[model samples]
Target: MPHFTTTDGTELYYTDQGEGQPVLLSHGWPLSSDAWQVEVKLLADNGYRAIAHDRRGHGRSAKTYTGNDMDTYAKDLAELVKHLDLTNLVVIGHSTGGGEVVRYAAQHGVGRVAKVITVGAVPPQMVKTDSNPDGLPIEVFDGIRAGVLKDASQFYRDLTEAFFGANRDGSNVSQGAKDDFWRQGMLVNLAAAYDCIKAFSETDFTEDLKSLDVPIFLAHGDDDQIVPIGAAAIRSAELVKDGTLKVYPGAPHGIHGDYQSELGKDILAFISK
Candidate 1:
């Protein structure tokens, strides 16, 4: 029930737990902070203060039909950081949240930030443009928007399979895991989910990546179907001044959840060092 008001007067919800150096987690599109349940437990048990938030119009936050862009999303996080007065924090973002972390660091400045990590993140830009020919086409995102608008529940169900690499042969997909993903997606507002399609797809994080001074850990799955690892993750690592890239073979976009133990180990080691 803890909430903070953004500069735009919209109330955003967040969960702050444990005590130690802070680790702020920003989740992907159509999902809420609930995505970090596993990571949060690991961090908390290992002596780190963990914070996770529902982005505006997602989860328990205000669900408006507009203002679901990356700039506003980043600003909403900024307000939450300021409210907590956290310092020396580590920000970890997945998928669209990775774009948020990049923009937040570039725009707001990581005055108190020590490091950042982006997993299967959309950055530098996801949609193919005249400048970035390697990016995904706009129609792909358009399909997502159309699908979610037409049938949100079914869209989320299908998304879960693709996200966790369950659609692939020999892939281990849990029904419970897929159900949890659907539950989170269902909790979000359809309008927010629809608008966020454009937000994550079109927002270019090139300048943001070039501007960040903090150390960054970029991890992606070579088999990611949602956000191709080569196009987004690999390219983003090249842009960061102090960035390291790690690719997991046969992993999917939801590598954070699919390979939580391994990813958590990598994150813990990075933060400890």
Candidate 2:
């Protein structure tokens, strides 16, 4: 239940456990530190300091109506890293959290970081534009905003299928995990959740990814319905200077969730190198 106050006066909750080089995790949209439960334990057990935090207006963090954009989200992460005075860090992000890591690295210069891993992340871009011809349409995100506003619970419930690859084929996921994902979405602040749909979808991380000098491991699900590999990890890996993309066949956007053991091992190996 450890909490820190951000510069914006928002109280952010985080969990820090074990000892060694730090391994920090940033969760996906409408989720919190709780989403990193599996990775946190795995990292800690592998002799690393595992830390995860609840983004503002999500989980136990303050439910503010403002600062739900990518810039603010990245700044919040910077604050947490500075507050903890952590170093030799290995940062990981999933889905929208991946964009957070990219932005954080771009702004912070990778001074304290060793390497990074992004699982089913959003980077380079998600929403389509003249530059990103392969991206999804803005109307897609608009629909998400509208859907969440209309019936948040149902939206989350329906999103679970795509998020976990259940809609495509037989999903390698448990019903409990799907329910947990739904509950986390419902716990998010309604206004923050709505605005975040715009943040993660529209924010351009092309420059940020290009600026990253540290090794970035892009772990994604090939069968991902939420953030397709072609538009996301595939292009994202091309941006970073020292990037490697690994796709899990028949996996979903929450690839790390279903492949926790393999993901953990791969991350540890990359960081160790």
Candidate 3:
């Protein structure tokens, strides 16, 4: 397991494979770099270096109690890019990781980044407010926190259905997908996972999205149950300075798993363009 110690002394595990223009993968909440397994292989086979890291408190990374917010998450990503000394990098994030990618380039600048892609990403903002009335209500996130506190294991197990839209009518999401989601989520530190709920749900990325000048590819499932497409990908595409939006009709939040073929093709095409 390749790992790097962040400035704050947290050991983050990561996977680096193949060779070419680097593609750094930042995964969604509660899960880890393993979430990008399909994309990593696809990129590597297509002659691109695919790198995915387990966020500070998920997967094989050290389970830390502090620094689970977006700012810290972005800083940790900056440290990873610095540690690898990568340039012309293409960063792709999913769900919570999408917020990290947006904040990373917004705060650290796009000196090393060449392109950005987000799948079923949470951004622009997820929580409802005066300025953002389309966003989800705070009560929704509070329910998540309650679920995490009451029974994390059961919470993860239950979340798997919606995460992949397994609960949907005529859905084809595999049993393996739900199982993998639950397994990876269960590996997360309770404290870090709990804190991350707020980071992904409440952190505003409107300014960050407005600041980006690099080419961005926003992909979201129109049927995404976890992070609704209207508030996330659609709105994010509107906010970014240079962005291309791809809406996967009837696709769920776990697009990487269920729609990897089409998603990979789009990513490769975007990188080539």
How does candidate 1 fare on TM-score? 0.97
Question: Model 1: per-residue lDDT, tens digit, 21-107?
Answer: 999999998899999988888899999999999999888898867788999999888888999998898999999999998898789
RMSD of 2: 1.2
After superposition, the stretches of candidate 1 with alpha carbons farther than 4 Å from their true spots are 256-258
Better model by TM-score: candidate 2 vs candidate 3: 3
Q: Rank the models by TM-score, top first.
A: 3, 1, 2
Q: Which pairs clash in model 2?
A: none
List pairs with backbone clashes in candidate 3: none
Residue 198 alpha-carbon offset, candidate 2, angstroms: 0.9
Q: Give each model a TM-score.
A: 0.97, 0.97, 0.98
Error of 3 at 156 (Å): 0.8
Question: For model 2, how does the per-residue alpha-carbon lDDT over 171-272 read when each residue is reduced to its tens digit?
Answer: 568888899999888889999999998889999999999888889999988887878889999998877899988888777777545477788788889888
- Model 3, 1-273: lDDT tens digits are 799999889999999999999999999989999888888998999999999999988999999999999999999999999999999989999999999999998888478888889889899999999998999999999999999999999998899888878888987877887888889999999999999999999999999999998999999988899999999999998898899999988888886444778888999999999
lDDT of residue 197 for candidate 1: 91
lDDT score, residue 49, model 1?
Answer: 97
